[model samples]
Target: MKRFLTLLIAVVIALSAMSTFAENAKTLKIGTDAEPIGFDPHTTPAHASIRIMHQMYETLVELDDDLNVIPELAVSWEQPDDLTYIFKLREGVKFHSGRELKAADVKYSFERILNPDLGALGSTPSYAGNIDKVEVIDDYTVKITLSKITAPFLASMSSIYCSIVDSEAVEANGDLLRADGGTGPYTLGEWVPDNRVTVNRFEDYWLDGYNFENIEFYVISDSSARMSALRTGEVDIIIGDSAMLSIAEAAPNVDVHKIRTRDYITICLNLNMPEFSDVRVRQAISLALDRQEIIDLACDGQAEVSGFAPASMGHWAVDVNEHPLYKQDIEKAKELMKEAGFENGFSVTCTVGLNDHIRNSGTVIQQQLAQIGIDVTVQNKENAQYVDDWKNHDFEMMICQNGAGSDPNRAVAFFFGTGANANIAEYSNARVDELCELGAGTTDVDKRREYYTEAINIILDECPNVTFASPYNYYYASSSLEGYSPTLNRPLDVRNVTKE
Candidate 1:
């Protein structure tokens, strides 16, 4: 009888061990607002898809906690001159399909960006403005040569546009779709376009192992729906505006994270038009509104009043007071409008995206501008249509919001340069362009700052954009999750995240 009892105890212990192991092997379910239109790192660089792809693809460089570029695929790099950079790729890294990553692949990936047939797939001119050539030095080394001295070279590499790709996979797939061909910690398992995407951890990943076994992304675009999903445990996390913070704070088993982002929402004025060419008119529009009131009503006080773009994340933020563009004065605004012959007010169409936060803010601005005698007709369109219209410069004014590039130079260049993607304002000042060019070509920090400061003054004086507020990156995570680190400007990196 004693022998029989010992055998029974052993069986019980074995079952308990198996149960523990099963509990530990939990899969995390993450939901986001729509998979980006394309999965190609070059095509849909800024879309949510790249964030998901980052798990499946490794970049040559990755940003650290302080927002500085650090080596990821490239073990080390050196600048032979002001315009040339040589990177030594890390050896032994393999793609998800068991092929080795090579320097030739890096060259191919970059060259793909410059292809004219790819449309906007080309390198973001704002960030890659100075890059002239990419030369493969050897099997594991490549040299990046710029046309001019670029201070933000490392920071520019941190962009999704520069993320490394597997050449074999690109050749096979023809375009970046939902597939397993990257060198990241996760591998694409399934993707349902516009609805959901799923990634499973790559067992043969070259870097540290991912915490979660699988990540499932569900696109929940509606703010209310996203909040409901988070509260009901249908999803593990939801990223949205400050308006969702109240609901998030009250929800059980939910944690709300608010990080200051480099994103800013402003009014993009068409400077190419004669009416908006007057700087006083631009300044008047800026000063006429009560920005703080708008922040409270529209964003629930979850935004910071912006001046000349937001500061870089973490320790690199320049002193806010040192920048003059952030100053607010209503009387001065009215005076400038009168000086520009718009004291009697004029009818203008303000185009806005239907994104909840943007639409809500546009509504608030419509009321505020009305108080100043500006007859603003608000036009709300779907996000895609709004982007297309804005890109083509087809609107008189637009409710524009953009996340700044990793570097200040890149950020300023995109918005203020002569013909940049976000330069919807169409306002051109020779001085501003010169400053941007100078800043882009200078490697010295102080010299770059001088150029940036001069450019900021020009933008403020010109009033291309009626600067409003810089919103926080707000998201809710399940209480059971751990090790999720959020960056200010970039999308959430889920490879290191794990559930408790």
Candidate 2:
């Protein structure tokens, strides 16, 4: 009897310990569609990678819920002149590696990003492309000198790609993604390729209210798989489009949130390619596309047909109705094709990413163009390969998404400006380039609008790329998850999030 009692006591103690662990160690599991390429904020440009950077690193500034610029590592900033800006850093902030945050760290981080030998992939339109030099004013302040007056510099500082890293950590760990050490809310704990990433909450995080002990980012590329994970209680949150949101809403104890974004889908035409060299051919292709039909079929009416630029770009985007090319006129398309010496239309391959909406848009475009006697052969590839092919200019045409920028200058520069790495279409117009420079250099809203409008009009007239639609993003969270508000730009900020 004594032996049995002792054994029972041991079992009870173990059970109690397990319960305590369960209560103390809360984890929020999220089903992400794709895995990020790396954790390096300076180089990784893709959306998945940017989301990870937001958690693992801290930027000099951040955006509030309204997309307004707010303080993060830097308490405040002031423009000393058109070409120079100064930042006052926050003191007592601790990096994950235990080094105190200082102005020199900021200077080194910016310098590393701007280094040509470093070859940062995502810095062109924002950080390295705009800023010329960084000067440490003191232990608590830094001054940035720009080659020219960049109007979007403040907002760009809030971008995830501009997140600051510890110089000591980077030197010790080498320039590797997984070697992340920053003054952020979390640290990468585990990464299983094509499976999941686990992050542990930093005990010394500067920001408060990050109550969850762990966050698990599970890879579920398939839409159904992601929803299934959420339904089966394997994941507490999943981000999807409108169709997936409908299914998630029907599930028990799930809440759906809508995010407005400037992200747009475009059929990027290779202007240097044989069939697309003629401007009439490109215009015909745009007229042949029924943007509304594509949006309705592919996005289930969850998207709006945008003009050549995203409507979310506020004053910069020309109204869709103002552009005659946006209207699908099959007869006019045929006339233009005939004028361009291809009345019967020519077959072209359109490469697309593995995402459902992109592939579906390609299919819809294929069917719609067939009505105008154009044969569009759809070619689908994985996301990474597609991005590489795009950068290499290896396709006749391609369907892809363009990320939103802090200003019209960024959006215009990304797709149409010369020397922009994101200009996959190989499009360049001297006038458009001049306007982009003008827009970037000016702080006057009216003057900037004029420059952007002219550039947008020129691109639309030239038909370098067909901007079809902007799809609304949807995210589903378990009812117990709180403080998760969707935004136009930042999607993965879970700092203040708590799972009840």
Candidate 3:
């Protein structure tokens, strides 16, 4: 009896120890869709790159769940004039390198990115392209002047591309990546190329909510692989699609999360191409596509068919059914094609990235355009090559996704503005350019939206591109994980996450 009693006590102690160990686990693992190109905040327009950089760096401002402008690094901001804006930094905030964040640092960061030599991606018309200069007023005060008054300037400040860097560290390492040059909740840790990047909690982080000791973002290119990782307990969370959602819903150990995103998909036509140069041809292609069917076939009915902007943007978005340009008419498309001197058909290649949904959309586009007497061959490329081709304007037709913004200026200005870097279609319109300028130069929300509205209608008429579907992003996590609230801007912030 004594031996049996001792054995029972030992078993209880072992169980308790195991339970404590499980509760104390502080590492949060995520399986992401793509590997980040680099940790340099200013270099890439890829969301994957920004998503990982967000863990270690922060912007001056951020949008809240309601898409309201809120302060992040800056305590507050004021616009003294139409072109000049001033910000007051948060006192006591320290960079991961142990130096206090100051106005000088902000000035240096902005100047470095703005330098044409640096070739920062955000230097293009879509992002910080409006900024004229940065001035350091004092240790805590910074002033920024814009060449022109623009609404996107405010939204641009919230982008990760404009993250303030530790000038001292950059001087030491020559770049921000692998240098721990930020004031955010985490510090850059190990980065194994094509595998994973780890961010450790900055012990001196200024905020209170971040609790995870380490957050690891593992790149699993294949969706099925990511789903398998989440299911088998290799990864705690995963960014997934409808197929993953269906599988995860049935998995007892997984918890599914749905984020209403402003991410919209578009099929861009190279206006430089001879066949796609005609407005009638472009408009016909737009009419040929059935946005609803694309959403259903590609997204598994987890998206809204839209025009230019997604329905998630509230009043800023145009309804597909109501918009004449978005209305599907196979007969109209054929007639337009005939009028454009392509009576029988034309063959064009549609390029796609590595993402499954995007690839599926390319395939669906190929099938839909066949009705309009157009033959499309879908070509898939590795993510890196795809980004390269996209940036160089190398494809005839490409299916891509863009992050949606609350402000109409950001939603349209970056992609539709003539000479804008994000304008993959190389679409040019004098009236649209004028509307973008008028919209951006104004502070009034309603008036700015009216400008965008007019510009959008003109863009539709011209048919430079087709903004089709806004799909809901689905993520799945381990049921035991807690405090994993994420937004469209920072989808994978696990700072407050804890193993329950």
Candidate 4:
């Protein structure tokens, strides 16, 4: 009887210890501008989608904090020739859907990305468009053949757009937009649209040290409100831009991190539009606005005026100061407007989202263009709707940010290259197209930079679209958080982060 009583007491004590440990486990809450644009990274070019998907999906390759290409699902890769590359998949990796990672899955992912019916409508398809075929050599080895020698092909695979999904689970689930079938550090727990997305850490995750048990992404559209949430301890972190940086800096118990990024803001113009189709009109519009002023007003002195290529691209870009067309000249702008027969000004719509910097930029640009007799109408849409409208080419002008790609070649190709998936501007130039092809094929660093410089110079003079400032990406977090660092290309990786 005494032995039984002692055993019961011991079991009770063990249970009490386990309960306390479980209660002590940390939960991370993050505030952002909006929830992911649906859940699939391939379908939407939204950063939110990529950020969340990074936790739920595993790319063959990934970028380290220094923007260096690192192995993820792929243990290593080799290129036997310019056109053919081979990859060896990691062994014993399991997907959230309980499927083992295989070469067939990689082959299917590449094939599905290129399939017209099942492919993404965004830049993912275009990134993999150069692929001739994906051949599965064995259960864990795959060979990818490209149509031509492409410089950014290997680096591009590191993107979230190239995230591998569990083929069997995705097929069974039927709806990929809501399904989570990936081999990432965490798996989707719940999603409430326009509100929050919650993900639980995957116990079977191959990599260790994913300290947090749960991560909740709350969508707070307003920058002030996001900052407020952080201040009140409702959320632990907020991903934002320069505008939110100041507020986070002023708040107590907060730490600010800024990543000097290659992301550039640009006003995309519909080249088919009668007004913008005229080069003089586009050039005049570019001349009217003060890019420096926009940077100061919208970005709170945390950014610089960006040129055709992002300033972060360094030596590869044409110096903005030396570019004649990039300089603002209000008189020249008015004269060009008069030359275009719009001396009395013409009204056009500038569509934007709820982002504070974008909205403020549009308003400031509207006021600036008025000086040159260009009547600008600001149209605010929800983030998803705004992106959809841009994709559908539904607006005369859309204020948008072009992301930094894995390489300079990909970055330049996304905006200036003809038939680029994100080329809402519908910009095309035979010379620029040839330059893009040349840049993609060139291996020498100097040769590649020269090719890009020529393309950037031509685009600057043509004014196909109005390039604005590149704002620094700032993330605010509670001081208690540790091991959190953001990369220029992919910000806010929480896999290794922990809280006190």
Best candidate, lDDT: 3
Against the true structure, what is every candidate's RMSD?
A: 4.5, 2.8, 2.6, 4.3
Segments in model 1 whose C-alpha atoms lie over 4 Å from true places: 1-25, 45-47, 116-126, 171-174, 177-181, 312-335, 489-491
Lowest summed lDDT over 10 consecutive residues: which window, candidate 2? 119-128
Q: For residues 1-500, could you state the per-residue lDDT of candidate 2 as single tens digits?
A: 99999999999999999987576348888888777777878766667766666778888887766658899899999987899989999888888888888888888888888787776654575445788889988999999999988888888887776778888878887874777767888888899988888888889887788878888888899888888888877788886877786687788778888876788888899888777888998999888888888999998889888864677776666787657898989899999989989988888999988467888898899999998787889998876787668767889889988865657877788667886777878888999999988988889999999998888888888888888888888888887778887676667667677776
TM-score of each: 0.86, 0.92, 0.93, 0.92
Please give the distance, in angstroms, between residue 86's alpha carbon in candidate 1 and its true position after superposition: 1.4
User: Candidate 3 clashing pairs?
Assistant: none
Instruction: Count clashes in each candidate, considering only residues at least 3 apart in sequence or on different chains.
Output: 1, 0, 0, 0
- Model 4 residue runs over 4 Å out of place are 1-25, 119-126
Worst 10 residues of 4 by lDDT: 118-127
Q: Which ten residues in a row have the lowest lDDT in candidate 3?
A: 118-127
The positional error of residue 51 in candidate 2, measured at the CA in angstroms, is 1.5
Global CA lDDT computed for model 3: 0.83
Error of 2 at 443 (Å): 1.2
Residue-wise lDDT of candidate 4 within 393-490, one digit each (tens)? 78998888777554666666777677777677888999988887887886787888888778777888888778888888888888878888767755
Error of 4 at 416 (Å): 2.7
lDDT on C-alpha atoms for all candidate structures:
0.73, 0.81, 0.83, 0.80
Model 2 residue 321 CA deviation (Å) reads: 2.9
Model 1 per-residue lDDT at 457: 69
Candidate 1 Cα lDDT to native? 0.73
